[model samples]
Target: MNSIGRAPNDQTADGGLLGLSQRLPPSNAAAEQALLGALLANNKAYERVAEFLIPEHFIDPIHGRIFQAIVRRIEAGQLADAITLRGEFEHSGLLDEVGGTAYLAQLLTAMVGIINAGEYGRAIHDAWIRRQLIDVGETVVNNAFGRDPELDGTKQIEAAEETLFKLATEKGQDGGFVTFERALTDAISVAEKAFHRTGAVSGLTTGLRDLDKKTGGLHPSDLLILAGRPAMGKTALATKIAFGAARSLLVQGRETGTMPRGSVAFFSLEMSAEQLATRLLSEESRVSGERIRRGEIGQKEFDRFVQVSRELQALPLHIDDTPAISLSAMRTRCRRLARTKGLSLVVVDYLQLMRPAVGTKPDNRVLEISMITQGLKAIAKELDVPVLALSQLSRQVESREDKRPQLSDLRESGSIEQDADAVMFVYRDEYYLQQRMPKDTMFDSADKFHVAMEAWQHKMELAHNKAELLLEKQRHGPTGKIDLFFEGEFTRFADLDTVHGV
Candidate 1:
């Protein structure tokens, strides 16, 4: 009888059960044994896979225990060999359970060579990944079979995605240290690109010249927060940046005579795709969105809008207007887009409207926001792309005398500020000024009302079509306010023409 108490004929040569669908969880007992043997033979071999391989990656329970003992001894700066491991196991009263000292001697004999330890470790890790995939598949099947009634179809999908993401993150061996010389070479390459590139921007351009100048453009693996009060053009600013990135990709593709290697993904949770498209049309065609919706445009304006839409159709931009999208689903979609179209940038309409991963239920809204922000930052780093997330400020900003937003005004400021590489506030003085227009009833005399009205009108003129982008926090650069031109009718944001005195 074999380990399962079945007839020897029921077992396959590779240790898998036969006549039971001929299937067994993926594993590599031989590889696990060889790796453990290599470590026991030469303690130095432990360093080869120390970064990624763990005891849990081994298939054989005894092999995993032996490997873990070796790891502990080696990490503690103590010599680890077959003799030392046997002593440790014996001391713990598990020597017989692990096949005794005879098994330790057998493992040492199994070692092919110390040089092959890394390969053996990788084989064991790969088998472990396959095993985890099987488990995930089983879970998904069980959930579908009504194992969890609370998980509807959509929730189940999200849960599956989250599980896969977690598995990939935990088991993937993509992170390691880079030599300083290599890092310096990359730095110089970036500098060279910036030196030759127009505007000397080293990263993806934000479409606004001043913003690009201040930030050197949006960088890869960066999480930038664009926050503002309601009607402060947060979405409009984020859309402008997305459009700019898409246009840059298109221009680069044209220069190379090939499709852009990557595209922009905009997740608009607050607005429908059509509404966002209309706003883009308004910005480019200089037609009011309200007028476009109401069919108030002339034939010429309609023709302009159609032409703009045709041009924009070729831009490498994708929009998903999934209302209140879960973070896991968003990550899954981004990964899919990256695989198919090559994702360069991700823009979320607003983080506050997003829900955390499907299965997680945070105790409070603050924790929920923290999870979302951290997840976004993780996505940016994992995908090596910039994530521009729009955010809403707390009402405290409105209650202040100076309505300009600050870092403290960020809703759930702690996590948002900590996770973000940059935090910017979109403040339109015109919007606030419009709300405080002088009223005749507030003044006692006509002259006083007229004087006040004149002053208010003057302030309005100064702030008309103007906006301020306050860079409250920047991890890599200076923090200051950037002036922008905001046309409410078109819902557009552009570089303020300070020299031209617009």
Candidate 2:
């Protein structure tokens, strides 16, 4: 038998299976050399890969240093050839380390063609990615072997995910400066879209008419904070917006006869996916969520509920109900969704329920919240999608006579307010007015009690079914209150009309 056909236990002259284990990590030395040669031959080739290919992507240290030196000279508008680079290295007393001028000249011969620079650069970058993945795998294995005692199984998984995410995004193509002319062209395109679309909305529709008019719809790359106290319908309003975005995507897809380019992602940290679906069903079917849960619906209502659910199933909306989800996990999931389904919007039910990236130990609650908010904003910018994160108001909003929420009322106000592009509060006067009903026992006379009760009833009638959306901080536009119709039974929100019940 040949030595190549030896058994697993066999230690032949070639070292058998052990030799395979000792293989070098992924790398492309020739590709690196070709890319460097292309750049040294013609500096214009640098522009082709400058956005994504960094010097660190090279396999050999000498190649990396040469690329870096070339980059410096080219960026400074100077010639970067074998002679220029050698002078640079000699001046820095590193010519011997970089194989001297002879090596620089040899790189010139290594070039296949300058036109293939982009391809060669990409190959080097791909090798670098593979190398990074191998390193990540090694770290994960080491951690699993109890290298990090503080990291439990779940935390180790989170750490691994975070590391991979960092690797994927650190040199991603999502960032770069846009020329003013290009930016202006994009702005004009948005304006043109608004001019042709109904309601003049240049962004994704929130399904609320007044809100759409005020904010020009839920814009991409914006971090909008929707804040309110308990029982104020923060989740309901956020769900409404998410559902609205999904419905819009569906309509566009139907019009075009192809899948829409994007979908909505709702991260319900406080509620289960089923519960959020129930609320959406209730809003659409005009049936109460509580009644649906209690099985109090009649045959007709059940039929309607099922029909609405079927229709909703066609919409491009996704829900994640992972309680206390870490920021990195949410980012990882969003990236997956964006890659697979094309993400348009992200809604975090409430930021307070979210934890920062695993392995981070914040010193205080404020710092923790700051990290969470900053991470959320980063996700929005990274994915180029809107992030509508729900927030809780501080108890201080209750101490005042007016229960309307202010920017200061935001829990962890400093970070939440500062990080958000816009801040809005959902306020329903009926909730507070109903609690202050006058009692006859507190009055000295029957007439006095009757008068107080009448005034209270009038106020209730005025506030009933009416909600206000206070746009407290809008970095892009004016801040004002938008009137909305709130259905308490179904937990639905719509544009309010004074003459008609909408």
Candidate 3:
């Protein structure tokens, strides 16, 4: 250890850890081996492994927090300098020891570096597997999985797994993953994995057939943007997806295991959770969305509402309807929900509505939008879950000859386009129908004048319950369009093939 390092304990002679090993690096080769032995002998983080060592690790708890802060800043694409690290510790009230602020800077300057996620991923896997092999009483490469020669393949596979794990335990893994020469190799592997189950599938599968077919599912660590202008059904689509994912996860998550249902956290920057729930209820119960808003339900309708509400009740769907939520505040809430209720999916209703950090608002709208989108992306990766955010399209879409949205139609399109793993646009042509009459005897059957002339005026009819789901960009799969049935009264989006016209 260094002259400034904490003194080592005398327990090393009795097969116990010298506390210095956890915080201070040994001064020489002999001391390094002894420190490694101390960690290997007494550490409980690894079950069966003698020791786990990384080339870059925390010297102490203070250093660990500083490292974590740097990692977070790096992931967010912000520079993590000494000043930033000190400020973080000071804010958290974590840097009271090691002679206060000046020492904090010194420690950080000495002990901060980046950790490659993929590289560390391999190391973690190795440490875990080595522990498993030793504790499970399995000989490393010495025994077969079974006596039968047919089991030889299984044993070989296990050996391969163990070998990979061993590589991870080392400070470095020598390029363990496959890098394909052709782009089609990526496609082929995805196809293979999709058709043949990769152990178990994670995440909720939205009932949208084409969406599920193309994207497989809304994957973890993804930022999926659903963009459309007002009255273009952006919020409705977002709410629909959130409802489906949360319900599905609650229905089929880890069946016969500890976590049978993974609850969803819906961070609504616009509507209240109750409002969202009512929308879901109206959709599920076939009640008119307007009627639900008007509270015009009869006893029978109320009964049906009560019944369907019960069905949706146990499905672990949580909603936090905080208007104008800051990104960090949203993150804190989501993490809390994840800790307490096992959160699986997050939904931010309309990204444009979000506020930037307290003191760091940009001067221009484009810059502000960019900051919000990037923050959402970071939150998605950090939480290891899918973040579905609703956005607004630019006015140019309506002005163009083609009403369908292009990449440029995305409001603050660049950053939103870059950060998003998938960008879906919702469009309704009938909403902008150019005063053309239907082809029924060249006369409009329904009109304001016609309604006035009729003696009975209780006329209400649903038009085509359909909308097109245009996949503008899909990072992992094919980008195309799919149509879905939209019930105006019920506020439900269903498969277009099953649509019934009125």
Highest TM-score scorer? 2
Off by over 4 Å in 1: 1-172, 411-413
Clash pairs (backbone) in predicted model 2: none
Error of 1 at 240 (Å): 0.7
Candidate models: Cα lDDT each: 0.89, 0.89, 0.64
The residue pairs in collision within model 3 are 1-27, 465-486
Q: Which tens-of-lDDT digit does each residue in 368-453 have in candidate 2?
A: 99999999999998788999999998899889998898877765555999999999999999999988999889999999999999
Q: Point out the higher-scoring one by TM-score: 1 or 2.
A: 2
Of candidates 3 and 1, the better by lDDT: 1
Candidate 1's TM-score: 0.73
Q: Ranking by lDDT, best first?
A: 2, 1, 3
Superposed model 3: Cα runs more than 4 Å off: 1-47, 50-203, 411-414, 434-463, 498-502
Any idea what lDDT model 3 has?
0.64
**Residues 1-502 of candidate 3: C-alpha lDDT, one tens digit per residue:** 4434545444455677554324433222222222322222222212222223332333344433544555566546565655565577678787674245676444433321222222332344444444444433344333464544443554455444444433433433333554554457865765576666432233356756656766787787899998886777777777788777876676565465455446777777788888888888988888876887788989899899999999887777888888998776676677667656776788888788898754476988899898889988887876678899898888877687768788888745548998899999887665554233334354456574454434222221222455788898988779988878777677678767744432
